[model samples]
Target: MRGLREWWRDLTDLVLPAECGGCGRGRTVLCPRCRTALSGAAPCRARPVPEPPGLPVVHAAARYADEVRAALLAHKERGVLALTAPLGVALAGAVRAGLREARWGPGDAGAVRARGPVLLVPVPSAPRAVRTRGHDPARRIALAAAGELRRTGTSARVLAVLRQRHAVADQSELGARQRLRNLAGALAVAPGGDRLLCGGGPVVLVDDLMTTGASLTEAARALRAARAGAKSAVYPSSAGEGREERKAGPRMAGPNEGGGVIREAICAAVVAASPDSFEINRN
Candidate 1:
């Protein structure tokens, strides 16, 4: 597994840089042109085909292509830490878009705007990956994004309570099912973390990129799996649910009844997603 991980890391173009993260324009970290490319568009639904069962509706600020792809690799694989800000800004946009249309479940209902606090939970990177990179890209970006959202007047914070439960094979070449099986039971919330989520607001799964939606699915599974026994509260899976709950305004659940419910978050956001995933959403 270690060798496979190293081989997969090598597969990415982690070349040392001398130019812009996006278009490699000289004398800039990210040129104006590439920055615009990274965030110029409105977020869109980018659902993977054969979408994993527990995966929620996800939004992406840009397709993972051209400059967006280049920039992501530069920041994540090559450790260009400066890119965290702009990438986070892009992710913030995606989070807003995800919240705007978020449904509590699969029932064509529950679309509430995140007028209050928003919790951004990043998918956990592998321990080995984090050690190799020297920083957790998703968490770093999530913090930047939380700042961006607060600047824009929506109360927000990054809740990095998820952790990898164990190592798995490198997922670079795995099929959708293969990836799912490999990652199944692979993530869990930090001990007592769900206690923080037992109240109000939307909980969004955040990630830098989405290739097959496997990691997000696993993250979601872990969140729902935790024993939030009182209300047994969960935002419930699916993209088209969440209407009445918003109007009723959940309180912390005691057995999900005494206090507010964790806003039953059932949505996600990403900086970029496979261009094909966006295509699937359009059709």
Candidate 2:
């Protein structure tokens, strides 16, 4: 009888695709209530207690609970493509929030505009995971987020120049320190990636979620390595940064047009984070 009821509902709506990816509400891709939960909140600062080194100033759109958690899981693990837009919208808000707080220092809040279009750099997923999932969720969301930003008059674009240089163990079971150790120097900027960003705008690292933030920290380290035209021996060979990693890297020039480098770490954004992570900003 429950199955029959669902069938009838789908049949009547004529667009009854699937239940809400968020809350399983019948007859809709995403119900209004869950949609609000996912994208309604103003983005806020999120920081992990005992934050790992190299993790940038980070912001998150929603708390990872209730419908927000459900929607992200469905979209990432279950391949619900329809959730990408809404998730992207939420992520864009986080990116904007991060930019708003980054590097103004009592100056104009819009100072980021003076820099150039915003560039979104997504952390690369493992090739094994991408092959298993059949798509790169982070990259897709970054593209969607860039589209949303452009639509709203922000010059934003996705720059997927970072690559996973080594495979990492599953971080789900690891603690903060272990996660950081596992991800150390695991990412590298691709050839010519530095030139792409040399004359470009502010960069924001984008990802689906931030738990320990180990992934984003590694990404920032790689970007910094590329920008400075230096190879970082942040970890020993045990961390998997091999001899090839010692080669000269790309150069991400600063705004000075000559030999300047952006020394400060970049910001990062995510759809949701641990609920407690948001509490740091409540003050």
Candidate 3:
């Protein structure tokens, strides 16, 4: 079934040539210009100006403007799904670097050890956005990343543990602060999924872009809440931090629930950072 689907997709691409994601030229998914532009791997932090609370260190493969942004938009928003392979390769490279940067040892890194599984959790997409796109782009990217990880003799998994409980404003026009505010309570981990997180492995969050990182931060929060619960767990926290359940907010989750200890995270994407707030590492 998968083989046939891929064959059909290849046939379709041959019939309808796609413009180069980088240069917008016809007959290619990525043109020479974009290929050259993204040929190298340079990872840098996509920092927050004010830097929201619990925002872990994030490393991006390239700047998000020009050809990089073009490639990402082309593949992600435009249904240029064929680009997943190239983007996945690029993401895998970034992830490997990020894991190295964090200094995670062999047994420490989830993707390295054969004993435990590595969970790549993607930031959830809003219901409306998913409906309009007919699929979840980030989730698809995560799956591609998992495939890349497995190809290199690593055990990986994509845990779609995030879900939106309510609608929120779109992030296209929002500034960093506004973006943080808009997504503050917009994510949650579903019930009965905590066991997957506590199974003892690394949980890396994957995303297509990192604009201020508000979404990923919230997603990490959900993971933290989930990881806080283990069968033979430590002592419970104080009242405020206790697992006082509530109705699912825009995004709500329980405590002690996590995908295990996230020794490090790698936020990989096809393109560079956006121009407005992106900082490239010239080193």
Top TM-score hit: 2
Of the two candidates 1 and 2, the one with more favorable lDDT, higher being better, is 2
lDDT (10s digit) by residue, model 3, range 240-263: 432323222112111222332323
Write model 2 residue lDDT over 1-283, tens digit each, in one string. 9999988877865544468988897767789899889888888888887787667888899999999999998888888888899999999999988776654311343655676788999988899889988889999999999999989878889999999887889888999999889988789999889766665778899999998888998999988778656322222343543444334322223332244233353778999998988778767
For each candidate in turn, the TM-score is 0.78, 0.81, 0.76
Worst 10 residues of 2 by lDDT: 248-257
lDDT: which candidate is best?
Answer: 2
| lDDT of the structure predicted as candidate 1 | 0.79
TM value for model 2: 0.81
From the highest lDDT down, the ranking of the candidates is: 2, 1, 3
Tens digits of per-residue lDDT, candidate 1, 1-283, equal 9999988666643543357899887756789888988899888888888799878778899989999999999999998987898999999999888766643311222322333467899998899999999989999999999999889866788888898888899999999999999999999889778876555467888999999999999998887666343234453442444666544542322231344434445578999999889886554
Off by over 4 Å in 2: 1-16, 103-114, 230-265
Candidate lDDT scores, in order, read 0.79, 0.81, 0.65
Model 1: residues with Cα > 4 Å off, grouped in runs: 1-18, 103-116, 227-230, 233-264
